[model samples]
Target: LQKLRSGQDFNSSHQYPQLLPRRHCGKGLIDGEKSTPSATLYEFPWIAKLFNRALGYNCLGTLISHRYILTSENCINFYFIPDLIVLGEYDNFREPDCQLEDPTDCAPPLRLYEVEYVVRNHNDYRYRIDLIRTTENVAFEDHIQPVCLPLTSELKHFRPSQYTIAGWNKNSKNTTGIIQKETIYAASSAECQINEEHLPHNVLLYTTSHENVANRTYSGGPVGAIVPSSERRFVQFALVISPVERCVVALDIVPYIDWIRANMVE
Candidate 1:
């Protein structure tokens, strides 16, 4: 709490040792069993891993504020508090640490939190709108920062025509242990429906190969784009709501921008 409130230098200040930025993040799997670390891997620091108490990592969420975590409603319920929220986590195989010096030695140091509440949407049950708050305040760093919610101007001018979806796999026959990235091409709303055939109302679609293994864990994950025209770096355009054989369905952020701004921690 002191480091979070004191605003110490994240990389250099040892007095606030807990605020140091992580050195490295993760490698991406091209197919199923290779490690390819990206130089721009840390671009999406706001992505979070939601781990259930009884189960392991359940889905992905976004760290929108120091106190609040945004995730899908279907991912969590009102009855239970999640076990932990891991921020800046890359490979699930490595033990989550916050101060590891070597990337090969371990995954970067992870900022973890205890769940405080599960805020649900009152209007639509399937919308899976939830605000999971932490018991304590979060300390932001180079490796851990909130993603900017898309504003009207930002979305209209900067949204990408293509984006990437990221997910993880453990190691072994059941898993491979590194994060996987898949490129999804943007489609018109009508074309999205025609392609997928079952894209729910109010949802957007991105193109997929239907053969990528990464698509399996893509549900409840992030789809971010590096908008070239606007010169905007990776801005998360949507959350993976559902995955079909040909296309992936995501909730359109345009309609919910007002709702997000209102409910998020200011």
Candidate 2:
């Protein structure tokens, strides 16, 4: 488990170099190579694709479920009904360089589905505007599979600790449309609360860039935790992305697991 750094100063203006290639070079192999998914906010099962013929640009999204996806509400609000595609168990953007020796490859082909709708949290506090936007309960289509909501009782099990996050976010300002991966540890509520003072609401968001970069896009991404199961295996999904002030510390308003089951589930 990764230890939390107390009083660690993360500057918002420090710039970092671009780590990965922008376009798919078709070099990275799928077999043997591990997929470092983004931290929660960027690690949605589905990638959102935004395209404006005149502007010429696009974005990606993580799949929450067959129907529902947890992404930045702002991204969707700005770019509505942009083409969306859900890639299942997809680790590499380029094709596999070598033949797959693992049995999982033969288990079944990962399905690529289309997004039908989107639902954002109405309760999500929006800044930069006087009008408050109500959170949408849910958005999905009949054909996609929905992820199960963790019970309220399950919240106690998820503590601030080590976990994996994945996404196809820009690695640096010079690049465009490349997926990068990073791992982050959970922050304590006290730490989050302290940082919230510098932020808009009592919300905190996560990001790989400790310092804010010009094109560091991490608006609507998944922020999940890996928890231990009774079978000695670990399961993830402690939180989903919600609006927050800044990405100072890897903090965001994770929908309280209990709150989700109370309102969204029967």
Best by TM-score: 1
Candidate 1 per-residue lDDT, tens place, 1-266, comes to: 21111111122322221221122211121122322422233545777888876777767887766777666666765343466898876655555522223444433577889876565555542454566678898887666776555554755456565677776643346654555567788766564456434445666777766464333566666677654433244556678776666677777655554555445443
RMSD of each: 9.5, 14.4
Model 2, 1-266: lDDT tens per residue? 21111111223364433321112111112222444332221123333333334443333444333233444445544444443343433333323211134423321233443333333345445521011111232233221223323333554445646543444434544442334444555554454445445554534444333333223443444444433443222233433243223222332433433222222211
Q: Residue 151 in model 2: shift from native, Å?
A: 2.2
Best by lDDT: 1
